[model samples]
Target: MSTAISEAGNIPVNAATPVVTYSPVVFDVPGRAAPLEIKVSAPATGTDLPIILLSHGHGETNFIASLHGNAPMAGFYAAHGFVVVQPTHLDDKALGLRDSGHPEAPMFWRSRVTDMHFILDHLDEIEATVPGLAGRLDRDRIAAVGHSLGGHTTSMLLGSRVDDPEDPQTGDLSDPRIKVGVILASPGVSDEPTDGVMMQRVRMLRFINFDTMTTPALVVAGDKDLNENFSTRLSYRSDAYTHAPAPKTLLTMHGAEHIFGGITGFDTVETTDEDPERVATLRAMIWAYLRSALYPDDKAWPAAVEALESGAATSSGTVESK
Candidate 1:
């Protein structure tokens, strides 16, 4: 190990603090087909705890695509002193809306954006449902972490705009409440011919404009996440960081795949690169990055980077900031 603490405290990369989790926090929203369901996770004891809205990816799996997914990431964030809220977006396969012929059937990109806003707007209600969590939240210190298609949603929430002429809901969907975002294995622009094949296939993706993504965020990309269905270029996933303006950071994993060491869930077959150490490093880096981003004075981000560089954590990847 690098012998460097991730932050001012001697918190190791693999620190596992006790966490409490509550699921199926239901909310009835207007104009929504079904009730909104979410899961909440937080440290057993903490006050003024920051918030992390974890948006799950649109995977082929039956369960991980919904609020029940991303336990590995959500649990870790909660254990490390953050209130993680995960919602079951309308696009989740478990909802069985794929063949319903709804306008946003397959992806529900717009609804995904709205779901996040709803979560923020009702933080008080969300907190009141869970015991010991009612007065422990720090609403001002909020960040978002998303993976895959959920990453695209996070980018949209963090100031990435779309100017689709055919779509009526296409506009500025960014939320000012979300201070920082972590985009993992998200889609990139399709400027080149061979790049972003999936973008053309996905209706909303054809109109994505990353030039307006001014949010301060950390984009995590895997060097080996080359899916021919999406794009032939390895840099496709890092486009959020590449096209975004200053105040951005990119963490390029050395040989990781789209799953990035199985972030979707624990021991799920969807993860092609199943390295537990790599996942631990990823969770640590995410916790540290959000910690520093929400609290600018905190040195957790830099310290974690130094630890990764010095071989303190597993050699999962390299980090760069702009």
Candidate 2:
């Protein structure tokens, strides 16, 4: 009921800009093997709007990127007037090393990295499909968002600094146009590729033995998460506040689940916690960080957080998590 009411509304990517959705197009990013399912929608009015591309975690393992199915987050952002892209990584089902051959799939852990770069190369995705869409995406002001495995991608895009940003490295993170920071939730292991898990991404950020990072960042995870340690470390957690050479923020959800507050694709009411109050708090933190980093000078964000603490964020009728 609440989703019906709220989802019916529209988010202004620009001032009173009429938002529109183009017919869906399915394609894969170059260099990867799998064919990605992508659909873009944005404001029709000609104005420069920020672009936010999303990469879902291993769908079979975590159910992060299901399209036209039960659980999905790409639509949420696209509906908010963003040019959203969802890469269909069929190789994840095999559960082996990163699909180095997949077009959109990152080689090794840098799959998230390639996803961002490929989207930048094909900026006309929205325009080619949807008319009058060029002005909506200000390529210079772009951001990346990922969940679980995808969350790791978010870190690669926005963290302090990569050891050699210009080394012509080719893997999951060989992009050259990542400008803004990142938003990562329930991130997986990202320690230097020493004895860490084989699935872990090889992080280039300074904290991992490099010098320092130049990009701002934010990390969010549930204390009850399954991969809390990896998530925390990647997000820059320390006993004391260790400000990033670039700005950074880290958050932990006390009673939340391993999946960063259980924002499922079903009904919001069906989420692990029917208690929207707390769940909304987590969501507010993420959305606010995105707004501040991507859409600066937006005051309503803080107020939205306050309201979401017990209002819309938690308004979902789902029961509280155990």
Candidate 3:
């Protein structure tokens, strides 16, 4: 962890402050100058907080987890110890990850890739304007975590090899600025005929993030999840990892469903009663990923992941997410 922060504006320091939600900050990318939403978590105080860019999947995106109220699943990371921010892409729909354009890269190119790069740029902009946050944020230690389509965006950030690459800002997944790598309840990369394989037909490959990713990448999926589904997602993802040459790990929430990947699914006990095993798998994998990715030197994360693979936490905290 490095001691360096950038400025967007000078946010006041108030420890133990009640939750504060603000209107979304709309930003534009460089090339297309497309509009993107940047929502900041209200911090009580302190400059040393680590920042995380939370992204939503394809369909509908809620920057803050208001509808769903789970800590690790919701705004709890910010409450615990993280400067959380989520951006809404242009293509979010009522049906999660389902859009008319579907998997076409150009449909939401600006929203997915360009807007993402712009958000990072604004993190600097905010750091510039916010004196308190200056030197407080570990700029080089930033990490991105997303679910479903959001995970695809994160892959672009992590340097996945994409065939029909539309986002021009593709950079090294292991760039120094990013010290941690994470993928939540997302489908894996593919060479097979699975869901979300837009560039499958392509013979040439252009990486949005890239192969041989140097940053430790975490790939997670729900077992019973049928959104993009586990079989299709994992097949493509595992194949990519096998060939990429990067330090990576894969985790599956045994029998876990897809909806439980984000805040929405974790909102209520009644809403999450579909798959108990999957619920536990979601927590085990996501929790461990955070601990491991955020705190690389910590041994507990490895142990937790080990337990998940062994199928421990099967019925206790696990529930099916819709």
Candidate 4:
């Protein structure tokens, strides 16, 4: 990875440390159609480290939609003192279920949310599975982070309920175990017009409600990411931060796109906006936010907010918290 100096003229914490990764850690979910598989990554050496459960975005790219994607963020988080866990959701194209008559086809949004809970339920198995990782985790400190459809999953875990369109009843998938969340380029409002196959397949998108998303979260949106297909207005993507209650933050990247500088993978074609500096800023700010949120007495989040307000970080983005 290329290194970029932060406002303090030093390498960011994410890039300064090294990490160890273990993949294909299998865990069984009783009654689920298939077993859940995950990839775990952590700092080479650290005790009492926090945990970050990352969910990958849904797309046609089979591998990327699984735990294999988001290496950039996973590695960064792992290197910077967090044990990152990524799961391969049922919606992944790699399973070749598109043509099959599966019940939860297309988005499988509900299953995605449950996948996270399953991971949490089996943390003991995860620790035992990973060599040299037992007793090194801080179980009480846990956070969920996601992108795109995965962000929707994370939101549900953070108390965003979905109203069952047919039943008029809401589903509460929120997990009290998840202390904080971070949403990257997730769909907002869901008021956009739809037609053709997308209208029929992704009907669950309309029921997403952020009014009850009271969890402390950091919502990151790209100013230039005009996802017209998802919403009529670009600002619609910022609904997570806009609709959620206090203790929420919005980080608007000045000139970023959906991928936010190749966060899905290193130097991949999906990254429309490739700015190393912007990615570096994200690394520093997210690390700071996670640290401060997990440890209330920590001042990293406040100091980073001050830096952003004072034009100390080259004005890469604007931060607003409430």
Best by lDDT: 1
- Whichever of 1 and 4 has more lDDT, that candidate is 1
Candidate 2 regions exceeding 4 Å error are 1-24, 28-31, 43-46, 61-72, 90-108, 159-176, 186-212, 228-244, 267-281, 304-322
Q: Order the candidates by TM-score, highest first — what do you get?
A: 1, 4, 3, 2
- Root mean square deviation (Cα) for candidate 1: 3.3
lDDT for model 4 comes to 0.82
Worst 10 residues of 4 by lDDT: 7-16
In model 1, the runs with Cα more than 4 Å from the true position are 1-15, 195-197
| Local distance difference test scores for all models | 0.86, 0.47, 0.50, 0.82
Tens digit of lDDT per residue, candidate 4, span 159-199? 88777668443578899999999998887766655522343
The digit string of per-residue lDDT tens for model 1 on 54-152 reads: 999998999899998998889888887899999999888978997688878889888898999999999989888987798999989999999998999
lDDT by residue (227-279, candidate 3, tens digit) is: 33333443443333344445666654444455553334544332333543344
Checking candidate 1 for backbone clashes, the offending pairs are: 1-312, 2-312
The ten-residue window of minimal lDDT in model 3 covers 5-14
Off by over 4 Å in 4: 1-15, 167-170, 192-200
- Which numbered prediction scores highest in TM-score against the true structure? 1
**RMSDs, each prediction?**
3.3, 7.0, 9.4, 2.7
Better of 3 and 4 by lDDT: 4
